[model samples]
Target: MNFNEVISNARDSLTVKRVYGDPYEKDGLTVIPAASVRGGAGGGSGHDEKGQEGGGGGFGVNARPAGAYVIKDGDVSWRPALDVNRLIAATGLAVIVYLISRPRMARARAKSSESPSES
Candidate 1:
């Protein structure tokens, strides 16, 4: 296959149908699972003085569950998927922010608690 062909194939895989799975009806409700999809492709070509030519390409795709659309009784609701990794990262960030601000917060509290000196 050629470089262009490989890239095209990679792009083709990232379709709406792939991102959102087929809707299935259960208990009079339609559930459509949604996902986040990403893809990348890279290619390179080289020609040597010995009249040798070489070309190579690679493509990769990744998909992660993002959420789902629940349709029931003519009403639609979105249910988000939970990512443990993201939650952990967020928690770590919060802790770091708190630790960095603790000193400033303590200083403010101390200043407020100090008795006003008689003018």
Candidate 2:
């Protein structure tokens, strides 16, 4: 397809409707699901020395759950998406940092308490 088609398709996929789903409502509660969107398009054209020409273009779109808006009793609030895997990784990293530092701290304490040799 041509670059124009690629760009047009990209625009359709990157619209707000794609990022924000239809609001769900029940019992006076409305939840609007939202997402993070990213897109890109690129094209290039070149001609060979033998008078042959070629061109190529492509587009990409990415969307992920960002969060949601909640409305109830005439009050609105936001609930953020939680990535459990990321949380676990961060916690593991912090624990590793603490464990790695504890040994050095103990050694430093021991060295400081030692009496220095004469001269």
Name the best candidate (by TM-score). Answer: 2
Model 1, 30-114: lDDT tens digits are: 9999999988998989999999999999898999999999999999999999999999999999999999999999999988888
Q: Residue 110 in model 1: shift from native, Å?
A: 5.5
Q: Tell me each candidate's TM-score.
A: 0.77, 0.81
Best by lDDT: 1
Report the lDDT tens digits of candidate 2 across residue range 20-85.
889999999999999989999998888999999888899988877889999999999999898788
Pull out the clashing pairs in model 1.
none
The global C-alpha lDDT for each of the candidates, from Candidate 1 onward, is 0.93, 0.90
